[model samples]
Target: MVNRVEITEAAAAVVARLEAQHGPLMFHQSGGCCDGSAPMCYPAGDFRVGPQDVPLGEIAGCRFYIGAAQFDYWRHTQLIIDVVPGRGSGFSLEAPEGVRFLTRSRVFTDDEVTELAARGEPERAG
Candidate 1:
């Protein structure tokens, strides 16, 4: 199956460091002004993944989630999480590590869309 999310090598390096410090992690990308648009990372269980979130697979050994509404807007694309060298404007765990998480995306191909449709629950909470 095609993953909805993946991490870049640079981001994975940062994730390794963060994992050594903070242990297991999770990611949530929400939508709104400011920090909401940035992917937020936290120690696993620190952030709640309720029913309104879509499980978009993992990046760097961490599960990635998107708010249901946010997923609606981004569902057609694959999320590629990367690290940029700067403190984030929000409270993601990596924010303290002098790097911020950013997302790059590409629209899915026709076949992936068809597979996703067949899955039917691709956008549902896990």
Candidate 2:
């Protein structure tokens, strides 16, 4: 059975406002140098949930779709979803769109944690 990702108050506000016009919220993980991970809330039907090759628990009324490639990349991720007031109204639908960055997993590889610490970066909590 699918379970929803924990949502933050800030995230809930964003989701509620968007749901009024669009459909459910959606979050997906992608590979990249920037952000290391990307959390996007897409209009329902804009993308399919997938073939279940990846692990995607639900969050609020949306689904956090983790791609197979991405899931394998961050096998130790403990991601969480939270609501935050969007930049502003109509912000959610603006062209190029608005994506709320949710929290990340607390667990990390020895190399990942070391890299963050070496860079003097704050570690994320579970």
Candidate 3:
């Protein structure tokens, strides 16, 4: 099955460092005004996953979610998480690390979309 979300090697290395410092980690992309679609990382269970959140997949051993509305907008694309040099939202755990988690994307190909469709709708968060 084609993964809906993935992380870059640089981002994965950052995730490893964050995991070591903060234990388990999780990510949410809300597409909200405050963060402007930036991917926010948090200690696992710290950021409550709303019922309207869709689980895209795991990235670097962390579960990644997107708001249901955002999912609808990005459903045809693959989310690529990468770490960039800068400070992000104060609420995101990566803020203090002098880097931020960013969500990059690429449109899915016809075959990949077909494969994803065969896999069925993604499960929603509780």
Clashing pairs in 1: none
Q: Write the per-residue lDDT of candidate 2 for residues 8-123, one digit (tens) a residue.
A: 76666766777776866666655644544546667865755555335456666776666666665655554666533333232224222354555555566577655544655222
Q: How high is each candidate's TM-score?
A: 0.93, 0.58, 0.96
Best by lDDT: 3
Candidate 1: Cα lDDT at 21: 96
Better of 1 and 3 by lDDT: 3
Badly placed stretches (over 4 Å) of model 2 are 1-4, 49-53, 83-99, 108-126
Model 1 spans with C-alpha error above 4 angstroms: none
For each candidate in turn, give its C-alpha RMSD to the true structure in angstroms: 1.4, 9.8, 1.0
lDDT of each candidate versus the true structure: 0.89, 0.54, 0.92
Best-first order by lDDT? 3, 1, 2
Candidate that scores best on TM-score: 3
Better of 2 and 3 by lDDT: 3
Model 2 accuracy (lDDT, Cα): 0.54
The per-candidate count of clashes, in order, stands at 0, 13, 0
lDDT of 1: 0.89
Better of 2 and 3 by TM-score: 3
